[model samples]
Target: MSFLDFLASQFSKLQKATLVESFQDDLDSSVTFEVVDRKIPFLPLFDVRRLEFQRGSSYSYSAIYLNKHLRLQPIYFAVQRLTESFFPKLSSLGSALVLGCAGCSIPRFLALSSKDCKITGVEYSETMIKIAKKYFIDDPIYHYFLLLHDDAFSYVHKTTEQFQLIYVDLFLADNNCPQITSMDFVNSISSLMAGDSIAIFNSLCLSKEDCMKFASRYASSFTATYVFDHQFHYYVVFAKTSSLSTLKAFEKRAMNFVRLDERFIAP
Candidate 1:
């Protein structure tokens, strides 16, 4: 390793981490779920709680957040940063749907960020839903969120209710859920959207080329489509309206939400 790489690795080892919980779901023994709490090395005042799922040699983090203190709020996770900046402009919207409710982070964030946006989160794992309730969805704001234990694919295909905003974040241990890239899933999501609506997709696991290709394949279904790069992560957005005034407004407001100094954004 180079000098900087060596230093970075050593510095990472300094953080104190505790494995608070671990379990292998009976439904899927291939993956193990864990919840961890780790203190920032130099900044002892802050701690991060993370929920991770591991399969064989690969792993995926479902949620990460600094321990909440009085009035101090830190938005560090890239997905949360994107959500914080992206959702407010759509405050007039009444409902949102989350395809994969890992750790309930997005659901909780959406509820807190937009009071009127009733959030519905669907997760396949029963244990995951229990864990989310026990660990993440404790705040009063979550009253606006209705978390269901069901396969996102089946739920999407069956739910007749439409949403003004939809967030697709399905993943399994660093691997993209097979259905997320499928045409059926795409069509189902399109049908679930309101006439004037937007969908945000998390494509962090896909390469830039693959993300672009995937976005392009689905572009014809939406009036406006955009692929955005933020802090080395990529997100694809689709809107039903011909005009992109809301998206443009988000660009200006995003500066306030994504400035480097406000949050420690390193993964």
Candidate 2:
């Protein structure tokens, strides 16, 4: 690895370790803290607590400030770019799906941004769902959000409903869920997408070789794909149908939500 890359990795590790350590210290003091152990093999103990902590469950899937602190990590900034900064029409979307509801962070953003948007979040872990409902979801009628305790794979295949936008943020502790990389699953999901639909696929802990190759292969499943690398280790893949290609200068069309700091951006 290059010297700069090594330094960034070390910095990221140190930051996460420090944040998680502090969060662990507060676990005993709060009554809201909920701990859920592995419901299946290879899953680690998932901890759900209230506020002020940067999210780092399982591995480092997504990091964001909870409660009032609001230190939205880079991956979330990437999500903001993908969701808020990609499509201006997202505000009017009728239906949306979030495959993995980690802390329900992105869905929260979606619900708030699009008043008319109806979101259906699928999470396998009941504990996470409970935590999300308590901390993430805002209102019952206004937000129009629903959380389902089911495997994302089965739900996507069986659901008769279609969505305008789909966010695939599925991951376990350290490894990504197997279906995230499956072509058959992607094809099944494609069937549930509207004509102008888009799907955001996140693959964390990616090597440069893996990122480039995976981007090329996965882009084939859609009309076009946009790849954004966040903090070296994470790759956010935005794949959309061919109809979306007609939009002129689509990337810059979506308005800015947050002005990201230079320190947080990847080279």
Candidate 3:
């Protein structure tokens, strides 16, 4: 099967996934959390577990587990693709910051992608941080990862240190953090990026107009802005320079991200 076809199959499997474990955090009543397992039909051995948040009638897959031994994320396909493709360009950089510490999937991926790069992740929910540690990042591979239990909004405003790579993924279930599209948050992210660095935002769960508006907010702070639609979700990229075109050139390997930046600004 083709790459798109394979993606469609994976997406279908998630939609029909079976619930494996369901539980609640007594400390946090903001959202109900669950652990689910999804596998290809008729392949019981090919199992992948995921952490999800139940919001009303919908579910958002926050992290996916291939195996306890592997430091990779199957749900964050777009961020993984963009980072792997763009990280090499910023060779001088050795630091990355992830605003949302859901399962530390992005941090884990960053660690494996660049061993020298120091990774820091901040999560707003203390319970969520505990859940990540207990379920996802218990392995010794995360010994060097700095995990902070703090609100992303407050942390960004107070942080003075800059990083070559930053990721914004503050989500509650399928709903995004309302502050994610605010000017203050955008400016904070801009301040965190070092020279010629890049930032990736998980812009899903927003309407098309809202997504474009959010991307436009970064145009004044960054040299180029690009948006990619992969796995039925939108991801926005902001960079100090126009280095993201390489991603468009290698669409086949990257699973063909539908570029939507042209609708608002030229990148």
Candidate 4:
């Protein structure tokens, strides 16, 4: 069968299997409470607060709340793709920062992918941070991960620290992008980077126009920008310089990503 046909068939089977129903049930069944230090419960569905979980030693999910309506599907897909494709290339970076780290999911993935790199995560909600720390403990990957409860925009504006990789995934809701995309905010983030820094921005509402808008905003501050779409999500990569070395690094990293995971290839 053709690839599209196969995808459709698989999707049909998934729907029939009641994937949404199963997740909803899991969310409903998961116990909710408070814990001290490192033992916390995972909430897979919408509740008064965001959900947090620690899977084995590396993977985890932290969010403000679950969507019984299943709005986070795209975010999960984008995070998975980024973890598989972008994390491997960041081994050499000494430091990294994740903006709008809801449940610290991306930070956990970064920790697992490169245990030696130091990671600092900035989050706006204290409740979310409390849930994340309580549920997501310090594993080998998390040993180098630090969670800071603060507004992402304020953190970027006030901090002068430079990192090799900067990741932004803040959002208003399931479908809305945050106001941090303004030119001033983008410029502030750009100023926090070193000579060879790379910034990755995640946009949930994916469309050609959305991609162009992000690219245009990023272009105002950065010397180079590239946009890619996968599984209905838009990703924009910005760089300080359009050097041959930088381009080569991106190509090498992308190729290595494709080699490591078949899902990394553009669909």
Off by over 4 Å in 1: 1-15, 40-45, 55-60, 64-78, 84-87, 90-93, 251-267
User: Could you give the candidate ranking by lDDT, starting with the highest?
Assistant: 3, 1, 2, 4
The best candidate in terms of lDDT: 3
Q: What TM-score against the true fold does each predicted structure earn?
A: 0.77, 0.66, 0.79, 0.64
148-234: candidate 2 lDDT, tens digit per residue: 989899898889998877888776544577667677787877788887776766666555566556556655556655555556545
What RMSD does model 1 have?
7.3
TM-score attained by model 2? 0.66
Residue pairs clashing, model 4: 50-64, 62-103
lDDT of each: 0.68, 0.56, 0.70, 0.55
RMSD values for the candidates in order, in angstroms, are 7.3, 10.7, 4.2, 10.6
Q: Write the per-residue lDDT of candidate 4 for residues 1-267, one digit (tens) a residue.
A: 335334433443233111111011122233232321221134223221224332223222343212323222222444444434433455565778899775565666566556587898997766556556655443444667878878888888888788877888785434445565678788888888777667877765556576666776556566666665654456776766546665555546554322211112111
Model 2: residues with Cα > 4 Å off, grouped in runs = 1-75, 138-142, 236-238, 241-248, 253-267
lDDT (10s digit) by residue, model 1, range 1-267: 235334534565666879889878656788888887776577544555668776766344554444433111222244555554555564555899988886876675566566778899998878888788787787776557888889999999889999988888887656678678789988999999887677778877777677677777777787656566666566776667544675565556655544321111111
* lDDT (Cα, tens digit) per residue for candidate 3, span 1-267: 335436645665445477766667444565677777667665443356677776566455565555444444666767876775665443334899999886677777776556677888999776677678777677665545889988899999898999988999987656688888888888888888887577888887886567777777667677767666775578877777454464444333434444444322343
Judging by lDDT, tell me the better candidate of 1 and 3. 3
Going through the candidates in the order shown, the clash numbers are 0, 1, 0, 2
Q: Which stretches of candidate 4 lie over 4 Å from their true place?
A: 1-89, 252-267
Q: Is candidate 1 or candidate 2 better by lDDT?
A: 1
